[model samples]
Target chain A: MLDVRFSDVRLPSGPGVGYKPQHFNDILKNAFPVQWLEIHAENYMGDGGRPLAQLRHLSERFAISVHGVGLSIGGEGRLDPEHLARLKHLVGWLNPASFSEHLAWSTHDSHFYNDLLPLPYTDATLTRVADHIDAVQDAIGRRMLLENPSSYLAFEESTWSETDFLHELTRRTGCGLLLDVNNVFVSAINLGYSPQGYIDDYPLDMVGEIHLGGHDEDTDDHGAPLLIDSHGCEIVDPVWALLDYTLEKSGPKPLLVEWDTDVPDWQTLAAECTRAQAALAKVPA
Target chain B: MTTQSDFEGALLDANKPVPAGLSDGSGRPAGRRYWVYRNNVAVSLGDALGTGFPAISKLVGPQNFKNLAAIFLRQHPPKSPLMMHYGAEFPAFLEGFEPLKHLGYLGDVARIELAMRQSYHAADATAADPTQLQRLGEAELMTCRMTLAPAVHILRSAWPAASIWAFNMVPGSPKPQAKPEDTLITRPEFDPMPHVLPHGAADFLIALAKGATFEDALKVAQSNAADFDLGATLNLALGHGAISDILS
Candidate 1:
């Protein structure tokens, strides 16, 4: 019943970019074809400020999505009610077109880590994650898209493969997936699995949105290539190829281009978004 | 059955030698993966503090900031996942922090910055109608109770924190001469702007904040600063939209 599919939602044409104050003047002046803007929910959690003011202005002009980084949904304990209240407050204020959070946990024992940490894929883990997701959706009174995370290491105790875990989560919670193609490629390379196989097994029908971001390539202690989801540079060719393959299967979804660190100008990020749009357009929807 | 609480308990332990039972694919212990989780938590919280308090970070270099942030994070893991409001206790922490006591004014500067952030994020409410003050005759205006704006913050300090913060924030601005200063932060528009208040402003605002009538606040202000100007001070507050309502 909570199937908010991409086919139901029409994403704006052309590319979208992250909203930053440094590029405010440029954003206002340039008549560029930027369609949407994504903001970190935690940044605007306060009562009011320049950040909110800018977001208000941008929101009026474009489609906005609230991408959260600190829910810690996969943690072993109960969800933080205080954090949930703040998120609910932001959702009420922004009323964004879409909302998303990572499938990782970031807190333990009442201490917040503030990063999207990986969760093991097990029946026990799956049930806990599904319950957490259900709690979040219930609290906010809306369905949310859960993104796949880029992991640097794998846990030995994971009983289920990543694909099966995601499929089970969607099945149990009735939540949609925000498939990050770059993450699949990163995990596949690091854990020595076929990225294509993972994609083939992915619950494509449950995918509501897609994220494309850059990664860092570092060698492990064994000198083998290790990909970290740095989100700092341009989307590499392999990730793009993976994206192409995903679009072919899942059809065009609301794709996002994320760049957090050492961010370039608005135009540079827009160019990356344009690439995603072009790839999505080429897919037979 | 790994209960949500059980999974959370394991994830919170930063020094876990191995992942124990939580693993995906390659069969590495959950402990090694938790290390990545630990690093991300510390780094992100540290980065959030850095971003929220840029002036503080600029005063102390990135390396020192990160080191201090790690220590601070261990002591004060954020109460909320809302990272923007994460460093509310940082100023108090800096005051008692033994290593940074030599800086003397760093804590007060942090207080000033924190107040500015609070003002910025305070709830949105309309300013008290100036006409409400008009109905009260001149005598009443001088003696009637005034309600300060929820968004206004008054910070009294022994260091010229407002001036120091201003000089550092503005590109190429001259450094402030060392002197004790009281600061008033207000969000008339969207962003909180910090202003250096004359000596009596802090005492005067404190009285007003405490629900004292204008006359009582004036008396406190005069006692705090021998040459307090009640008219000018009231005018400054009114102009800045820092006074939300006047309760007769």
Candidate 2:
């Protein structure tokens, strides 16, 4: 069998926060409890700027994780060579502790939509996503992590279950998974599945990192609860509970708290990191 | 069409019904839920444009700006995934849009904002040693060519675009007068600032940017305006670290 399993990643099994420039000074002063930082790859792909300068400084002190938002690993077309080259350039220079992208496709034909669109989990999609993951791993010469999408709806054409598809992706491409607990909760509510059941079936052994973020609650046409993965506010109580549930099974992993929109003050975000630290503390590493 | 084609086609067009295969997990049509994807595509791209051209958004009120963004995104969807590079064609779009043609300055103002963004993200370069220019004799200095820093940008406009930008973006600034102006953007530090260039300086910088020798660029500046002040122009460029290299 081809060795589909990856060795342990370099990130420490502690709390990390998505690094925002607004909290740059605060992080420099006292990044206590927060062990690492994750940055969106597309934001720092510029040739030179304050973003790169701050990143260069932060990488010296913290294990930087480059999380890409633009690779479109599930796009039906061939992976964009120019975007792949850009990703390679960034990874080559930053040498981040880990790199990951989503299981969503945001581009179609020549247009790049600024949203992570859902994909049907069929054999064709599985093959396409696996090929793209292989291309990314080959381009960057490192095992990449694929994050699950928070869906507001599902395609009836999907044959494989989401967890099964993710496992098969790891099996074929040797890429690890970024198990976003918040996404799991959101998808559970929207798709009428048990969040715990989803996590139970998840290939936790293949998970390299865990992501927790906030979601906005609404109703579908039938008044069923619909959750939009906004990542704007604090992780709600239930999602945090989901984190505890995940940690109990997976043990300690590099936990990240992501607040992309309406980012809070440094102390506010730091408090979320403190909560993540507490969850990781419960599990024996 | 494939599932993606149908899904993506309906995403940007709110008028289109939900694609065939999607469900809200109840075996019924995904109606309001499908709007989640539709809203995400439009609103996020709208936010990117709003961030990229704040002055444009300010000039066009919030609701109008939102409407304009809806029309713009459908017409000129982003070619690249990077949000920072999203609105390269927006300035031209504003110029050609029939309803906004009355505000002739909007296009130029958009240009200023776009240039500021480019200056912010351009590659880093070290300023040339001022002592090199000081040590050289006048003849040697005139013969040498200079390279502008990667973050330096020159924008010429018929409207006082920089002054208008200042009045809108910076507080307590004087009102812009009705006159033509040229703007120079330079990143001496982390933040890039736009400066209203003196008369004829844009010509001089444009010449230098195109590899003209100092003497040749100086002539171009003087020819454009009889009262072109070389000392002041060089002072602004050197003070802002805009001159990256002096090739002998």
Candidate 3:
């Protein structure tokens, strides 16, 4: 197995906040206690803009981590060559401390959906996912972390459990796990399971980073509990509990507080990072 | 359709049935649960449209804009992963859209928004040193092929696109005048912003953009508007860092 530290990842063992343009000045002027900066890879894909210029300046101060939402590593069709080339170019330029994408697919038949959709985990999918990972790793010349998705539904045809599928994929392709704590909570509540059990079964030894994001709660058609990974609110108590639970076992990985939509002000975001730091402090060294 | 495409097609179009073999993990079909994905796709794409074409969304109001975006998504799913760069066809879609055609200015407004996005994402180039043109004699300067910044965009429209866009963004602004308008977009340093072009500035800029020399561009501008203020236009271009090269 490729050791997480020895892989392309060289992240600092502290909480990082997802970089937003609104907070760029605050982050620089005040010098928040952020250990690194995480940003969506696609947001910086433009040829030139304030976004790219700000990214260049920030990368000089912080360890940049590129999280991709559209690689379609688990798509049924072959990976989009153009998208793959863009990722390669970005990774090559940034040489990010950690680069990662979802285990879920977002593109199908050339139409790129903005959301990450779930896929069935079986022998056939296992081979396809492994091949896609290999291609991504080879193209970027670096190992990437495949994040466990927050799923609202499951496929009956799935033979392998989500944890087992990720374990097998990492084992086959030498990739790493991102291990999103809130996804565990959201998916657990959405599809009936224990978030702890999911984390216990996760391949923690291969995890290079961890993600904690906010989600919205609602009910399904039958009035059962439903949670959507909206990333628009503050981290809830249950998700905070899940993060502490995982940190107790996984020790300290590069934790990121992701608030993509309805992004709060810099102080609020920094406070979220502080809470993550507070949780990280509890983990045994 | 193949199972994957079937699932995708259904997710895109609400009328299509959810693909086979999905479950809610509670001994039921995943149809209702699958609504989460559908909702996510719609909401995220709607948000993308909202940002990419904020003036359009603003002009149509939030609720109507979202409903329109839902229909727009069903017909035109984003072809690229860049959310800001998505909805390239939205302006044209609004033009042909039967329901919105009555608000004919909607298409022109959308066009301006699209132009704003395109200008913002254009390649970064350095502005020409003022001294290069200053060093030239009058005859040499007139024949110089001025290269404009990649971020400079010329938007000519039959509706008052700039005023409509500006009025919506700034509350309590003057109501837009009902007349044809042309605009120039320039990204001097950061965010791309639009400026109202005089009668012939678009012709001047478009000519210069197409490799026209200074004299040639002025000729085109003069033909379009005999009163074209060359001094004012040149000052605007220079102030915005629009000119990148002066090839004599």
Candidate 4:
């Protein structure tokens, strides 16, 4: 089969929310400001069920973004063929407006840890990640977007900065970027860097989408502040401020507010979208 | 070189120290910062199991279940990336784990919950023509082969597993009696509903699932229970959308 190049499909530069099953009816009834919906690629992979049915119904009414939590694109081992095939099958049918995966590894030696594990941004690691992204884009016949992970600690072996690493990935594989601003905040605070400086260095033109979410505050061993990307609460003020700063630089992109844990009712989530829309409004795209 | 190899190992095992060369931005040893990754991995996988086996979690209490999940996850880390497909071995794990040995029925309850999840996700199917079975003569009916829906699942347990599940999950359900039960899980629509099978129905269903003719299946059920009510069992199956087709 001939490998198709990255898709020309695009999502509107408006607020979107991570699709949740509990909010299905509410979204269909009144999804104001939410121009698109993003779903975790792994959730809808079943052969046939309510999940697929709901997705099918929603896709007809809204532009869908297939955001992958798995795929372990930075793993040392080769990508799991079966998982890649499942992803391909979903993309084949869903034909979502966008597709994205993380810049981290969750699977190693057959055991999926069920959490996004970080990677050192060394030259060898960059090549491996680029290769995995290339394979994914080839398999699904579409350009993939890679999202940076929230960091708790940095590796001394990493020679490249996170932004430089992401820039090189897009340069190498022709993939886009999913700039998760909340992750930027979490990583900056945890690693003693400036979030705004990180955004300035990021290759924003290649970013297909942007993400905002919440974090939990804790302290490292030295009692320095550490933020865990919990995604359980409303987007905090500082993160929203960071989003405003990021928009000032990048203008409007397909912004998403992810509340995966302790998900609020439709009204609460929609309010977040309203705030995101206001942020996009500030930018003169 | 030692990056992923040692990193993943420490994520699963709490005792393992933070991998070499990892530190906070100030170059301090990673220390408690490494626990962030460890907590994410343990808490997320544990939460998945807790959601997967709500009845098991309820029976063992939340804290005990969390500890069990920690151990179970280490022993059987998900081979698949799909979170729903994780914890396939948990029911068996409960059956053999020495600490939970006294609660022998916990495994069976877990089985029912797993079956319900599977049934909920099983392929959609058209119900078999309900009138077709009634139209056939007794001899013809016995000779015909019935196709079961992909959503149909039978679990025969020595404990009243279905009853126990109902007591825990369903409000105002009766307390479980100490008796054997055979559970038939079916998805007539979107949600899976578990029905307590009458005596010997499991034999009949198991035989039918194995491609036995109606005559053979009925004989198996009747042999198991001399007074097996074939009509009631057939009504239950037909009404619940368990049968997908009738092949003569």
| Number of the top-ranking candidate, with DockQ as the measure | 4
Off by over 4 Å in 3: A1-9, B171-173
Which tens-of-lDDT digit does each residue in A99-162 have in candidate 4? 9999999999898988999999999999999999999999998788999999998888889999
| lDDT tens per residue, model 4, B46-101 | 99999899989889999999999999998999999998888889999999999889
Go through the candidates in order and give the clash count of each: 17, 0, 0, 0
Residues A182-234 of candidate 3: C-alpha lDDT, one tens digit per residue: 99999999889999999899989999899999998888878888888988889
Q: Write the per-residue lDDT of candidate 1 for residues B66-136, one digit (tens) a residue.
A: 88888888788886677667898888888798988887887888887777777877877677777787688
RMSD in Å for candidate 1, one decimal?
3.5
In candidate 3 the C-alpha lDDT for residue B228 amounts to 98
True-structure RMSD for candidate 2:
2.6
Query: How does candidate 1 score on lDDT?
Result: 0.78
TM-score, each model? 0.90, 0.97, 0.95, 0.97
What do the candidate models score in CA lDDT, each in turn? 0.78, 0.91, 0.87, 0.92
Greater-TM-score candidate between 1 and 2: 2
How many angstroms is residue B49 displaced in model 2 relative to the true structure, after the best TM-score fit? 1.1
Judged by DockQ cut-offs, is candidate 3 incorrect, acceptable, medium or high?
medium
